[model samples]
Target: MSKGPIAVIVLSHRDSEQVTRLIHRITEGTNSFAVIHHDPSGEPLSIPPSSQVAVIPDPIPCKWGRLSLVQAQWKTLQWVARNVPEFSWALLVSGQDYPIRKMSAIEQELAGSPYDAYLRYFRVGPDPAEDVIPWQALTRRRYLYKRRVPFSRRSVTLPFKRRHPYRNGVELYVGDMWFNLSAPTVAAVLDARQMSERMLSYLRFAPIPDETFIASMTLNVHPAPNVAHDSKRYIKWGRRQLHPQIITAEHLPDLRASDAFFARKIDRLAHPEIPDLLDRLAEERTASSG
Candidate 1:
């Protein structure tokens, strides 16, 4: 497989040290660059200076379950497009995510793959297939009237019906927020976004917009863009869970067997031993490959 340069974009709200470690691991022996986007609302991340890593000076104030999350990703994508044109692929990872395989191996796997984007996706709304996000989620975000207390931390929503965002034959597609995207795919989505304010407004009001925005841009377009139903990240989404299962030492065996490039949602404060084990695994993998 012919290797090409890759740019790893790390979106972090906390855990600066871990993010730096991740950058070091990726840049140790590979032709790759790291772009760190830290949310300004979180604790200030003290990322060590590195020739291979660039941190965004003005980070977005990302909010949970809001359009701000998608805004942060938009900023990161724009930064990569303007600053790292040499990279053929852009991989988005969170601070909690750590690589499971050697950088060389990841590059080799991507080099031979046919898909332009490695992301999990499914159609949503109007009698969607199984596993797709139900229409209720979309309705709650877009159609229902939500009322919030001025100072209290409580809100209420009233059920209602309004126009679905998908207009003029445009279909809604939802997927995992993390993705590994090719240059062409990124360019296409950004270009379309710049040209369409209606699409932007529609997605901004949609529920969990981060999960739907990019998927809609690429998958809904004509000629159906090249996409693969895999993110190459080991994430366990348990039943009725709002987020992925937190990774711990108990999951090490499954992580090793996954053959994924990275695993997600790790928190050192909650599971201190897990990161140590993962660090050991990374070291062993790198040494063996070397």
Candidate 2:
């Protein structure tokens, strides 16, 4: 295993202060560092200089539910892998994510994990015999032909009629985009087969391609390596609109008990105490470990 630090790729489009704080939180007590990909058109960011953090210059302009988001993330990761030699692992998280556990322990767990990846990846198909979930409308909407009704606000997905079912020969997979990838799995994703011309061609017009691109690419390998379906993240999308429920102080009990290493969609400005509570939890872990 590589003895290098964990690399955290952060997609920050807003709230520079919160993003800056998040970078420090993830790297404060661990060797892990952060690469911030702030949107080129978003709010200007001012973060303190640190050896543990670097910001990608001119982050691609990303539109939600568009291919640009996926492209920016993939390119940022590739750049990091080439620049930061032998990183033990790399994880993708948003600027809104905060560690629910100690960063050092989180890094240790990933560094020692047997699984090559920790993300929610499952095949989407109608065949039950293949251990795939029933075909989902959302899946169809994402993969099938869709025209973006641009010039609104964020990219909107009004999928065209099922028309030609987008299928890559039973290899279609879907999952949340956030994930942690070991060095080998990272290399596998970077392989020519995974980042192929065909895959890019298909994803160019697909809705929310970022959610499917990495999962479809990484999980389609033959003799797939052990992959934990758990993303080790706590995010609640319970019957809400587009945005997830913002974590509040009331969620402390759940946060304390969850196995998740990180939680997202948290507004630190709104729930400032949340971080202090998490910091206490980390201290409690340290105390217990001691």
Candidate 3:
């Protein structure tokens, strides 16, 4: 879209092959740079070398629902800001994510878009608030007693309750962690993190802080266009479920019809046909563009 290269930051703690396929799909026919933040303690990453792809040198030991998850994402943004400044947009995808549309089409659209970010966010608790289960979870800092190592196979969450920590004026916004951000927005977010020690310290114990960290930071920048609060990722979060549903071939028709640039929770082992289907769809989009 912008005729400029895009940076793809992938945070993965799962299978390396899936991560590799995700990287390949993103790099196929687009001018992009990809950086993978592999979980240092998870399955080893073994993707073949390509100039467009880089695995974070000091991979964070990412733990689910822990501050480490947010740190890993931050580290990726820091890497991009310092090393890949030429790119205008940074699309955050997970290892199990796959391109729904052609990479070229995504590039062309983003290149032309006026918005600084493509993400969705809402205040965690409004006075006449939009009520959701995560509302209470986010506003209250429960992790102090309930925290557990996110990626640890044997880790267990210790349950406890505490009063909500007072936020004098700090606001918490929640949204999907994955997003597409313009370079300026990315830089702004990084800068905010560096400057906001109080906010960071507060969120460190906040439940699922990854969902709130970047989404909340976007609110700090000016010009509404710069905070385009729409994260164009296709994920189905079922009620009471800790994770989104894994994508399968049954969603093929929906995947083709939707405008989302990418879809997530696709496990190659569970639905091996899905990657090929996405590949074919990507090729079709590329052909049509040509």
Best by lDDT: 2
Give me the candidate number with maximum TM-score: 2
- When sorted by TM-score, best at the front, the candidate numbers are 2, 1, 3
How many residue pairs clash in all the candidates, one count each? 0, 0, 14
Off by over 4 Å in 3: 1-3, 129-169, 193-195, 223-225, 286-290
* TM-score (all chains, Cα) for each model: 0.85, 0.88, 0.85
Candidate 2 residue-wise lDDT at 235:
83
How close to the true structure is residue 216 of candidate 1, measured as C-alpha lDDT? 72
Backbone clashes in model 2: 0
lDDT of 2 at 117: 87
User: Per-residue CA lDDT of candidate 2, range 1-290, in tens?
Assistant: 66689898999888888888888887785689989899888888889999999888768988777788888878887888789866888899988888887888888787778888888877766554565444344575456635444454333455355333235453677887898888777877787453455677766666567778778777865457578998888887765367678988777788777878888777877877776777787778767766
Model 1 alpha-carbon miss at residue 197, Å? 3.0
Q: Give per-residue CA lDDT, model 3, range 1-290, as digits (tens).
A: 34557989999988888888888877775588788898879888899999989888898897777778888888888888898767788989888888888777888888889888888777655443465555445443333334434344333345554333325544656778898888778877777644355556756655566876777677654443466656888787777888988988878777777778888779888888888888888777767768
lDDT of each: 0.74, 0.76, 0.74
Q: What clash pairs does model 2 have?
A: none
